[model samples]
Target chain A: MNEPPRLGDLVFTPEEVQKRVKEVGRCISGDYVGKKPVLVVILRGAVYFAVDLTRELSIPFDIDFMSLSPFRPGLQRVEIEMDVDIPLAGKDVLIIEDIIDTGLTVNFLVRTLEKRFPRGIRVCSFLSCPARRIAEVHVHYFCFEIPDVYVVGYGLDFQGYFRNLTGVYTLYDPTGRSTQILKAMGKGGKR
Target chain B: MGDFSIITISREVESLGDEIALRLAKKLAFEIIDREGWVALLREWNTELPVEPPLEEKEQEEWMVTVRTFLREKAEKRGFILLGRGGQRILEGLDSAFHILVVAPIEIRIQRIAEKYNQDRATASRILAEQDMQRERFLMRNFGIDWKNPLYYNLVLNTSFYHIEEAYTLIIEAMRRATNKVPSVPVKQRSLFEEKNFLKERVFFSHPSEEDFARILDFYGIRWLYEPRTFPLVWDEEGNVVEAFAPDFYLPDFDLFIELTTQKQKLTWKKNKKVRRLKELYPDVKIKIIYARDYEHIVRKFGGRK
Candidate 1:
């Protein structure tokens, strides 16, 4: 009999995650030496990641937020909804995100942010789950590449639970395709 | 035409405004847009409602994060009567919105609340006072509007004098009537320009072509009513009643001011005597007398366009 596999591999422990973010911070600070930078963080899910990323930086920068959702009441197919508008004007902006799962949210945000005529913009994400990616996004810096799974813990939630966990984990579903993929493949290397 | 998004109600409480809104929802087949609707139905901020805004910096930082979350999910095409949030100001000039204000006398409001809450006059009064405080704060802090003012309302119907059926009829009647009317400024409005913020131009234009004054104001933007609408009749304050000339056109911003003109020679001795007497009492009174020649020059220069 084969054992079930974990969705989120041990890409980095909490300490490693912190170090990776610091490296991204150093890269950003060097690039934006004399520019007026406004870090526009996509709200809700990005709050935790944004906090960690900003803390890594030593440079003085302002922060703003915008909220967008693909799901709305009357629409069946996914579409963008803009909320909490900000005036980006001429400042160089950087978007810090938690995860780019489908890459839909990040792509939509970048395209829309470009229309504001910011001096420049780049994206940073904590996780990029490429195997599950449907939409393409250009990420400047990211910590880990996660597998396609129902991820939870480390501020990620499954139905608003498990957001306070110290490390990321995946929940199992009996009928999940990712679980089935693991089963078909047999005992693989560590998650 | 598109799905109705908002129904802004400027109601004086205890007038069955809530019930009427419910009934209107049934009549028009719409839902009541409360705070719950703002959270559950709409997105712009996070789902968690803030108990209080921050007094300090770091706490404020987190508050803003939640605020953006709330805005992200705002209702696109909601159908409901939004009561007392000063919702109209939020929807300045949206074409798809219907705004209605309900009002009533103090006594009737007091009576209604007293009956509904099953409380005496004193408790009802306290409840009303608390509600008014909340509304006042909400309007001032959230919407930046004076809720007590009737100017905030589209159609102010007094519920103290009128019953719910009458009020509802008015709500429906107003809705019916409103549909026929223009959405934003009422298709046919009283103000010619509907000029909310009419910036004053540098040049003073006080002459007409018939008067032969032809100076054109280079700075002033063109308007349909820019032509000299009235002739200046210079009045000298000879009579005990002050004598002064009125400006050719009424400028709503100023008081007792006149447009200047080079037609000093047009003032006859009789007119000059009255002007002198008027100037003596009200030395600062603005009397504009335009030269007949300036109007003629404008017509000649502009190829008789005016």
Candidate 2:
């Protein structure tokens, strides 16, 4: 039988996550006081982060969700599984993302929303991994800057599991070994 | 109907082709042909959804052929004024065709473009230069012919000095001189000239984030496509669907598939599994996963401004 995957060192405790979220929320509220900016969330993953972030925001803002898929090659279009229902014209928009990877997805989202003639656009993310970025995406609000390690729990998941974990933890091999140890083992075998 | 019926206008950027074409079509009582209408018709035949301006070279070439076929069929009927798209070169064999090249000095063209487009001089200049290059390259690539070659034209008018009315009068007078005579067809010369190739790379975005990505790529002159196809990773017990991954941007020039993970830790493992499978299955394919911090850095550098 296959062994269960082990959770590595705890990176962010539940108390730490709450502290960061409240701090980000306070910052956003202070900045957007009377603007009534719309919060547009990127769905399927950011849903949990969006809810937590929204609860912290004292400012009045509407929320919308959008999902996008890349277009097949040879085609010049992208597929929108779902689009924001709110009209964005002349409105300040705050895009709520769970994480920001290469910045392609958010960059793409920002450009599309610009066409709608929004007065302003900003991005807010729960966490970020800076090393793998290829496209530039402006993020106005964020909680933590984590390393480029696979994390799960508190809405971040590994293999569609572990979102229910209360704290953010690094994922490791099922054999209870850190990835670095496994790498060393493989290198030793070659030697 | 006289044998001479077609009047083709070959013009440089901001030389007033639209104004001249409209007036010429009105005077001759001929239908004003728009290539866009033909494209719409072609779209109806090809796909249910309205097609956008083609981004692929092959697709653009196909559209050009459609344009030629549409114009050729239209010219078979009565007198018509064909504007741009090397109509003069394409229909040069027709004895009834009178080709005119309208040209202005670069300064005059720049000024005209600035005023007409309500753009600043610098922007207008950039636009005019790009348009000029595209036209020149298009003609050279399609017909292996030079746009400025006087041999391809019957009359070359300097639009800088002449008013639109004066230009129109000159064309009418020239038409009268060749009214009853058939201009002998010049032997078709295939030009060996090769124009510089330009990429027709473009991507349409459904989300604002994707749109931002495209702008950055355009600013950097890097070509990208969004989620073009699905790469199947894992199969179910019955070989049914399990996990499939569609990367956000495929940078053809770099031969890399970039998947941006803005998702919290939840699905990264699944995504990694799929990416690993993809690499194992297609060993030559390169894939990269960009996390949130790097993307924020990029956004900080290039986003929010334009």
**Per-residue lDDT for B213 in model 2?**
58
Q: Cα RMSD for candidate 1?
A: 28.3
| Candidate 2: stretches off by over 4 Å | A1-4, A69-78, A173-191, B1-222, B225-306
Write the residue-wise lDDT of candidate 1 on A1-191 in tens digits.
74543244323356666777778888888878877578877766677777888887778888887765434223333234434355786878888787775454576577567767888888888777775443346788787766554555555654455566555655554445445554454422244
Candidate 2 lDDT score at position B83: 67
What are the per-residue Cα lDDT tens digits for candidate 2 across A1-191?
76655677566778888889989999999999888999998866677788888899899999999986533324444556799999999999999887776566686788678879899999998888665555567778888876555566677665466777767776653433334543443311110
Q: Per-candidate DockQ versus the true complex?
A: 0.01, 0.03
Q: Which candidate number has the best lDDT?
A: 2
lDDT of 2 by residue, B1-306 (tens): 345567788888888766777877888787554466434554665664223323333444555456556556666776677666567655655566788898988778878888889987666765665577557545544443456868777789988878888888888888787666664665452322112111123344555666665555654434555664456555544333366677887664355677776655455787778788878855666778765443544564333111
Candidate 2: deviation at residue A83, Å?
A: 1.8
Error of 1 at B24 (Å): 66
lDDT value for model 1: 0.53
